[model samples]
Target: MLLLLIPGVGLAIAVGILFGWRWVFAPILGWAMLTWLLGSLRALGKDAKPPGAPADDVVATPVGTDQRTLFWCEECGTEVLLLVRGTNRAPSHCGQRMHERTEILN
Candidate 1:
């Protein structure tokens, strides 16, 4: 949002310079004043906590012994135990050889 305002102010200044009008400074000045006002308001509002939002709501669940699980890698057919802090959606290792079962020929 702040990045977009810079180009607008620059264009306004350039046009103002080209036209020899002092009004160009008005836009740039207005933008700066508005930016400062909005920024201060935003800062002031930051301390007002929203309802029903717990302070620790963003915390991640700790990986525990109960979370020990197994996953199979489709790419290499390898079965691996899920590690703590491991990827939750997929197998941990890449290019692992998956276990295969077959009947032996007599």
Candidate 2:
């Protein structure tokens, strides 16, 4: 997997084998620092969002008493019904958040 190249256990093992155990950490830490720097720069240059990530603008609000609410996942269209609670923490489904859609209950 591509994750094996992420300068973790594999690198540690290779460094420990090829060099000495003491020298192993030198490349590991160097790899970590280099990856962190490069990752930051790559993130700064990105315009497209990673898939299935939650929206940053969403904020949870408390639900009203004597009412019920429906929440739906925008990504997967999964729906949930809940009695109004003191506070609302929107539900999650399929790795995405479910948001409330207001409609008259009467």
Q: What RMSD, rounded to one decimal, does every model reach?
A: 13.7, 11.6
Per-model lDDT: 0.59, 0.71
Deviation in Å, model 2, residue 102 alpha carbon: 1.9
- TM-score of model 1 (CA atoms): 0.32
Identify the runs in model 2 with alpha carbons over 4 angstroms from their true place. Answer: 1-67, 84-86
TM-score of each: 0.32, 0.37
Model 2 lDDT tens row, 64-96: 544457889888788887653434457769876
Show model 1 residue runs off by greater than 4 Å: 1-14, 17-20, 50-106
Q: Supply the TM-score for candidate 2.
A: 0.37
Candidate 2 Cα lDDT to native: 0.71
Model 2 deviation from the true structure expressed as Cα RMSD, one decimal place: 11.6
Model 2 Cα displacement at 31 (Å)? 5.2
